[model samples]
Target: MMRRGLLAEFPTGDALIAAVRALHQEGYSRFDAFTPYPLPAVQRLLGWRRSRINYIAAFFGLSFALGAYLLQWWTAARDYPVIVGSRPAYAAPAFVPITFEMCVLGTSLSVLAALFVIIGLPRLWHPVFAIPGFERATIDRFFLGVDESDPYLDRDRTTRALLDLGALRVSLLGEEAPPP
Candidate 1:
């Protein structure tokens, strides 16, 4: 038998969040959400955690600055001390630009590297793509979905759950507005 998922859409963030919380209370854990713009309130309600990408990027950037400064100083002042064109071997001004650039470059590279390491980049496909009406997600729509894989999923029961949440209407994703 072909499996189906229930995708509930909402006109606003409040409605979507209310539905999400209600579903969570009903033990619906397997779901993914989409929104046209950020909703700080919903992020809190969903219990989303802070991403470590920023921390990792900052750390890498700091490390790069320190390493670049040390490498330049050590080579010019201590390893093979040589003053070029009457300039001070440890002149700080000359190092500033290169140090700043390296910091930015390293931070950007590592952030992208971390993204690939953490959330596989180039993810050409996802299971949710098989669910109908999901294409609206990129437009002016907000969606909270119950996957067919969810334990609580039964076509009738899921639809009933959506309706109970005061959904404008519940319908099979691509069925063009099912008889509610």
Candidate 2:
């Protein structure tokens, strides 16, 4: 059977931490904490996997840069053979500006595309936004939740559990989870 997500909102950081620890110890493997600012300790608690997009971006950027330079050399020197008043067949200095521009352009464009895909842009809406009292996550609240997608998540039980954990407020979000 499908299950809904549970969200807990805390009034203070200490409360947030305690609730997170409680959930973590309770054998809840799929959970996430959210706050207005960085919470460095959360990573240790969650143990998120390393992201490979950086390596991908580096590989793509380097390939693009080299391809840009080589393309310029081939088109200007060998392929098309443009003669600007006998200024040598392969004038490396003359090609510098366009080559540099293309390299920068290619790297920047590819990186931007990668970022859009990585971050899931153009569809920036999130399930957390639907949680009650969650709008304050940016202002002055801390939140934690078991995603509706979590296999072991039990909607009613999780919501009740969060409320008992000293949540200032508890609620559910997303189409899968009903509003509190």
Candidate 3:
């Protein structure tokens, strides 16, 4: 949907990173940065906490694996015990391969689903797309956006802070900007 925000252009990746850090330190928490390439250091500077997706994926994997194994055990050992070649009906060892496969499958699917949810996928539009010159962010420039939804956001103050952080240009996002 349409929402107001501020977009600041940085001449370089380092400048973008620094600006994000400074803005965050200034207590502006609702913001995002865009760059042409991945910047590992920038992620740490953005104040993002550790992701819990891995843990969630692990939980799903284990649950699915255990369920699969238990189902196999119930069917083989209890429900319909098939004794073949004098082998035991339970056959725990025989279930290992299928259990491992189930674990892998569950982890893969859970992680994929988690990523979609976390990243807000299937979104065909975003406020940033309305910012002029924002396309450069995917080519040669860097961009840092401060969302107007931030409780502490003051347009004048935010613009000033962005300029102070060495932003080459700072402009209010048109589509997302609030009514005057």
lDDT of 1 at 20: 83
Clashes of each: 0, 0, 3
Return the TM-score for each candidate structure. 0.75, 0.68, 0.72
lDDT of each: 0.74, 0.74, 0.84
Worst 10 residues of 1 by lDDT: 171-180
- Model 1 residue pairs with clashes: none
Q: Give the per-residue lDDT digits (tens) of candidate 3, residues 34-62.
A: 88998877777766678899898999999
Residues 1-180, model 2: lDDT tens digits? 113467778888778877778888887777777789877677567776666777766777677777877887898899998888889878888877776777677677877888788867877456666655677889899877677777667877877888888987777656644334
Candidate 1 residue lDDT tens string, 1-180: 112467777666788888888888888776656788887767776667778799999999999999988988888877987788899888888888889999999999999999987877776655546556657667777777676777977889878777777665554543343323
Off by over 4 Å in 1: 1-5, 80-85, 131-133, 163-180
lDDT comparison, 2 vs 3, better candidate: 3
Q: Tell how far residue 39 is off in model 2, in angstroms.
A: 3.3
Q: For all the candidates, what are their Cα RMSDs to the real structure?
A: 5.8, 4.5, 4.2
Q: Compare the candidates by lDDT and give the number of the best one.
A: 3
Query: Clashing pairs in model 2?
Result: none
Model 1 residue 35 lDDT score:
81
